[model samples]
Target: MAPSDPVVDPISSRLDYDVGELRRAELAADPVAQLRRWLDDAGRAEVPEPNAMAVATVDADGRPRVRNVLLRNLDEAGLVFYSNRLSAKGQAIDANPVASALFSWLGLQRQARVDADVEVIDGDLADTYWANRPQGSQIASAASPQGEVVADRAELEALVERYERDAEGLDIPRPEHWVGYRLVPHTFEFWQGRRARLHDRFRYRLTGGSWEIDRLAP
Candidate 1:
């Protein structure tokens, strides 16, 4: 917004947690394997939405934006997340395919960040994921223009209802714009909280055909 824009109510927020120290020997040599271990820990600890992550991308004008997306797939290939290709984020990815993703598991006193070049996943993969989506979500995907603003809530609701009714006896096809992006990260950073201000951090960089791990000063 411009400097002349009106302001809303001012507010502040903060939180502190009692977290355990992270040891260098506790991490896996392979960053992807380490990430998987941490994710499993998040699930075992019952941390809400263990697969939710923040995806960061740049707009056409060079402004950066971030949004929370479910981590659909992960492997040596990269991290995958699905979205409407026509949405603001998808459009941004089209214009600028490089992106970053972050997973913050505070309950586990851990966080992971990946920075990489991004691109749409194969059509077969997107098709499989779309077919497995819940029916209600498929309807919403069909009805919603994603980033487009609507004049009224009723209009959107009615559109969804129409799509649902039309697909009563048929499968809800994925919108043409609905697809996935894979982040082929060259760098991965994992952080673990500790007592006092001394936290532990490690970075894994893709070098040659293997990974090079380095400890970061906390």
Candidate 2:
């Protein structure tokens, strides 16, 4: 095939982001509030999985890993997400509590980065969230040994079936391994894409019980 032939050529892919500008005057004084504003914008724009974020953690072996996690709760205290304690991310967070989470609202050409130290939420809170989850998800989270090697799909289906049978007519209590963590961010950076790759970035730093915003070079 000729190099110029479109059939054999590399698939087309590129983005010339030209989203709305992010200015200090338009931003909320608090980073959390600013995040909420962007979230609202993302929702209005019909961005898929607006609350999904890429959580990054480093294992004991010094390898970096990133996975998508849903944002369950957000407050001044921290950003909350849940995971099974036996999962790779859970183990990594336990080993090194410091982590980073990134929210890429590519539909709006915006992103948010958070660098934080994490702590497990109270048992009561975890219970509350677990109780609200669908029965199937609860059973799956409780039954499956996350991150563990299994024989096959059949093994998992069997485990789920067994758990469902055992949980019949009874409340499936939240497993100890199924817990929530709140990431208390010390730094947050917000980015808005622009034409010609001249983007806008603003970072908020927590200091002396207050937040200070600093504009960063694109």
Alpha-carbon lDDT of model 1 = 0.88
How high is the lDDT of residue 180 in model 1? 89
Candidate 2, residues 1-218, lDDT tens digits: the string is 65574654445655778868888898899999999888888889999999999999998888889999999999999999999988999889889987899999987899999999999999999999999999889999999998899999999999999999988999999999999999999999999998878899999999998999999999
Model 1, span 62-179: residue lDDT tens: 9999999999899999999999999999989998999989999988778899999998999999989999989999889878889898989998998888888889989988777999
Which 10 consecutive residues of model 2 have the lowest summed lDDT?
5-14
Off by over 4 Å in 1: 1-18
Q: Top model by TM-score, which number?
A: 2
lDDT of residue 162 for candidate 2: 93
Best by lDDT: 2
* TM-score of model number 1: 0.90
